[model samples]
Target: MDKCKVDVAIIGAGTAGMGAYRAARAHTENVVMIEGGPFGTTCARVGCMPSKLLIAAAEAAHDMKHAELFGVYPGDVRIDGKAVMERVRRERDRFVGFVLEAVESFPEKHRLKGHARFLDAHRLQVAENCEVEAGRIIIATGSRPNIPQMLKAAGDRLIVNDDVFSFDDLPDSVAVFGPGVIGLELGQALSRLGVRVRMFGASGGLGAIRDEKIRDYALQVFNEEFPLDPAASVSSVERTEEGVAVTFEDGDRGTVTETFEYLLAATGRRPNVDDLDLQNSDLELDDRGLPLFDRYTLQCGSSHIFMTGDANNDLPLLHEAADEGRIAGENAGRYPEVRAGSRRAPLAIVFTDPQIAVVGMNIQQAHDHCGGCFEVGEVSFEGQGRSRVLGKNKGLLRVYGERGSGLFLGAEMFGPAAEHLAHLLAWSVQNRMTVPDMLGMPYYHPVIEEGLRSALRDLNRRLLMGPESVERCLDCGPGA
Candidate 1:
């Protein structure tokens, strides 16, 4: 029954919403953020933080298994799943506290604990029956795990990533139903902790990643090292008294069933758009429930309404979401197209063993956009001086660039510290850095990163002789 007013109203105080609030504060007199859940964002609560904590726990377990190689023979190796969950909870709580404290630091901004649904184009209704009329709205509702409908037949038998971390006990085995980012990361983590992991997917497992070599590296790491089976596909899942029974159509299309204590439906994530009732605001939705927006400014439906992050689906990277939220907030508060357009597209990395990162366009993608004229070069870390020193022998760096222009278009890496290396390549692509220019840049020796420098040298060589004369093009070569 209470009525409130603000200049700007932000829905969902997650990463994108928090970013919008901070950016809008500089331009608006009154900025308020409305959240449905607790103060912490998913990334801080059950998403990034807790998952990484679990991965850290798994890494410890794995290290003990390899202790013999380090000349320290622990009589036997074992993992306490309960203890790992406790650590995950502790770390998650700490991170949540930090986020709650950080959100409180913005004094002029109001934080309300309630979901906000649009009452009209300019009005929003919150929990406790409160209404806030605002000049503009920024929607950053984020996303939820999308378990496939067919697999939902087993009630309470399926668990998503969010609730998986809260389990009091570890499953004896798990059948991961998708090969997306979460599936691979969690599968590898759980597998390392001694869980029998069977990973299944429809096609191009890990569809988000553009580089085939990087995907192969991920598949190899999980299947070979952690003992995960990548080619399994589930035909049905049924709840059993002891656990869950998953029937799969094997790679040869033979029927097989396996029982696991838990099943994680890590297929993908859908945008949180259904609850908003967009008809109240005249917003249009794509077939997949994403908001239709101006790609450049992120303005949706009308000038006063904006969408950011996973809600729009350009690229779901956290940094990209935060940047989009800032842009949306800034543009909504003031004039449209005030700042220079984002010249660079976002890049993504899988946090699995031998992390994979892809920036800009790969050779095939670039060729499709232009012509098949880009020069591709690759260098491996196996024989590189630095990789051998670090005890990581397997890794490769691939670069794609225009022929005569020598402008870098894309770069991908698979190996130790590849996540960090990919960002540099992303920056170079955005800046149009040339092979000769980037190659001359100082690189410290005996570091995994020097692999990038090695790739640059190979690229420079190919650029000098032209694409036709090139041989041993690692990017196009077998196994990269």
Candidate 2:
């Protein structure tokens, strides 16, 4: 057997693994990245980029259909599903090429193409022939879409994100399982692109928004685009001549049966650690079969071993995975004594129409952390100037802050320009900004940001500082 030694051996070449590679390279060149195949990161290959492409196409089709609302008349608008999917694949391949080029650019000896299995804590065997002995190891093997066992028998009729974007043609109708981020985004986009879509979730909420009001608003907006059954609980899935038949209980509405040409399962994802031979290591695993690692240092039980990205099951987003990878890489290079890094405030978004963003703690989290001491301020877009002008004057925005101190805790919103607004709120929350600090910032007139400003002002009014605090600040001299 061929044997080699390296400072670090990183498994998987996705975002997390590449991130670790770059960071580790800064400290040591004795780092090798091993992969089985499919070189591109999840975002570039399937997750973010491809989904956005489909959403963009759907948005264009939706805009054309609504052109008459703006006093524009265009007749006989047609949508070519084949062309749309072709563009998605063409652009997706271009993105994937960048990653492949980067990986290929590395020294031939530094890149290994094979599956790696841990033979011991400090050693790994790749594809039975090659052996690698590393002082430290970083596991960045990402994740794969989780398809329930009950639906596995349906075979190709049940699809996941990995294969959904690469379809040669769009299905005539689909039953979307789970109304989380993937389901809502794709289900709505597919419906807008002229497909019959029915979305069903076991829970009442949509996406990860914990604010009940915002969730309700999201359901309302999503229902307008496609049928949503949030209370659905699947009982059985059976293959049918046409496609598949699903029987689910629709809380209060009783058991219902639906047939679709295809079923898209967006329930969740499982970490790609099952085949990593983790049992050979000294690290302890949780009930989910994920290694118990420090969230700050990304270090597994052993100081020389670390787990990052979706494999850790901490934060599965691409950006979060990258951050975790950096932490793991840096600490793994440091060895002996791991260094802890600060994690950013939680930020997540659902790219549905009018969008939905959850920043930091939501309503329930704030209540759980601070009890009744937190104050909530809300602004409805029903009469917002910019939203009315854009004919999207719906949804709501709510901000939570400490009642007495006026410190911003978190925010949840389902409204226009929510993606941008969420970023703004996330930054502020990460910095622990106060209501007064946010209110003092400039807000342009007749814009969606004004809605956020209004919510902050409402929150400020509820705080003990009130308007007097602003007056006091203004009364003081420039340098006071």
Candidate 3:
């Protein structure tokens, strides 16, 4: 095959790969992006974008079922799973079409539609018998659902988040085998869609939030809202006449079996590193199968090659992936003398019902390091007017700061528009804003924006009264 030369060759056309392509093109003219499978990503086809649409449909169905609570009784609500699935497919198709069109229009950017394998340190072989040798390369292959091997006995009955919504009909019951973001979101979404879902995880938690108290409250709310069995762990899965029989080791010497129409193996996700045949290249791999890169520079052993997105073993959210790709591409194109000056830290958002957003250190983290100077505050969603009006009033906003100095170290929230709130917190943490600086920002009234102000008030009070002061107040307090 004839060797094709380029300034940059990015493997994987997902969010990170596309981001690198866009960012690299701004600096250099010769860029090529190779993607295996379809041109679009799970985010466009089935991941975040499509799954959220399905969840919204389920929410609508759930609301209709309990419409009598609002005094406007709208009769019995019936959901046609077929219609719902059709709508979901339509939405996914529409978004996928946009991505396909975008990629097709980039005539200057060579988009190869096949698997990419490393032929050498700087050369890659594409399935189309084409070879690409670039000055710099970026691997942003992203990740896939990490289903547990224990569920493999059920074979066809088992599905992961990547293909969960592709079922011809809604399952009568489902057993989700994890407590991470994907598991929790799918379990909740399916439960809302009228499936009897029982979720199980290694940790007795709802998601990966740092605060144990908040985790407990989240699990409690999830259990109350849906059928959750945090204690259950699947020993094996066997097919039954109805569906799949999931056997769980209940205790030291006992096992319990439950039959479900489907088994969603929502364990977790791992980077898409193995498929790339990195052995042919000089890239190093961490124990978790992620690309080993400098924590700050995101550069592989050779600065000419970089890894971004989930492949980098850092933050795996879409926003963080984009940022990493931008940084990697910019640095790759910049003169070596100037590349060392850039600074960046990642922030992430897990898009569950009550979205989990995080930036910088938690209060405990700050306390462990800068003990006496730490001031923290928590405000509940029950006090937010927008939350009450939206009827999603079950979350809290927490902030950590330095005493008297007011410098914000971190913030977290599990509530409506949490991702949006994370942006504000990220800005504050990145700039090392003081408590007064954050509180001074005038938030609009009667909107979700008030949650930030309410949270800031709690931090202000905590700072005024000192760390030993009671964290909670009633009646006149912001939390109240």
Kindly report the root-mean-square deviation of model 2 from the true structure over all alpha carbons: 4.1
| Model with the higher lDDT, candidate 1 or 3 | 1
- List the candidates' TM-scores in order: 0.91, 0.95, 0.89
Q: What is the C-alpha lDDT of each candidate?
A: 0.76, 0.86, 0.76
Best by lDDT: 2
List ranges where model 3 is wrong by over 4 Å. 249-255, 335-347, 367-373, 383-386, 448-451, 465-480
Model 1 agreement with the true structure over 1-480: per-residue lDDT tens digits = 988888888888888888888888889868888889787887888788888998888878877787766577887887888988888998899999998888888773388778888888889989858999988889998888887787786668788998878877677888787877788788888988888888777765563566677667656755675434545556678888867888877657588888887788888888887888777987777776666887567788555888888777676767877888888888777744445336355587877766767788865687886688777788776776656554666766788877787777887777778778888888787777877677656666446666776677677677674442223325423322
User: How would you order the candidates by lDDT, starting with the best?
Assistant: 2, 1, 3
Query: In angstroms, how far off is 431's CA in candidate 1?
Result: 2.4
Residue-wise C-alpha lDDT for candidate 3, range 363-427, written one tens digit per residue: 46777868657877887887667777777778877878777677788876677788798888888
The C-alpha local distance difference test score for the whole of candidate 3 amounts to 0.76
- Candidate 1 segments whose C-alpha is farther than 4 A from its true place: 226-232, 251-253, 335-345, 465-480
Which 10 successive residues of model 1 have the least lDDT summed? Answer: 471-480
Q: List the residue pairs that clash in candidate 3.
A: 42-47, 373-403, 406-434, 406-435
* Per-residue accuracy of model 2 over 179-199 as CA lDDT, tens digit each: 899998999999998899998
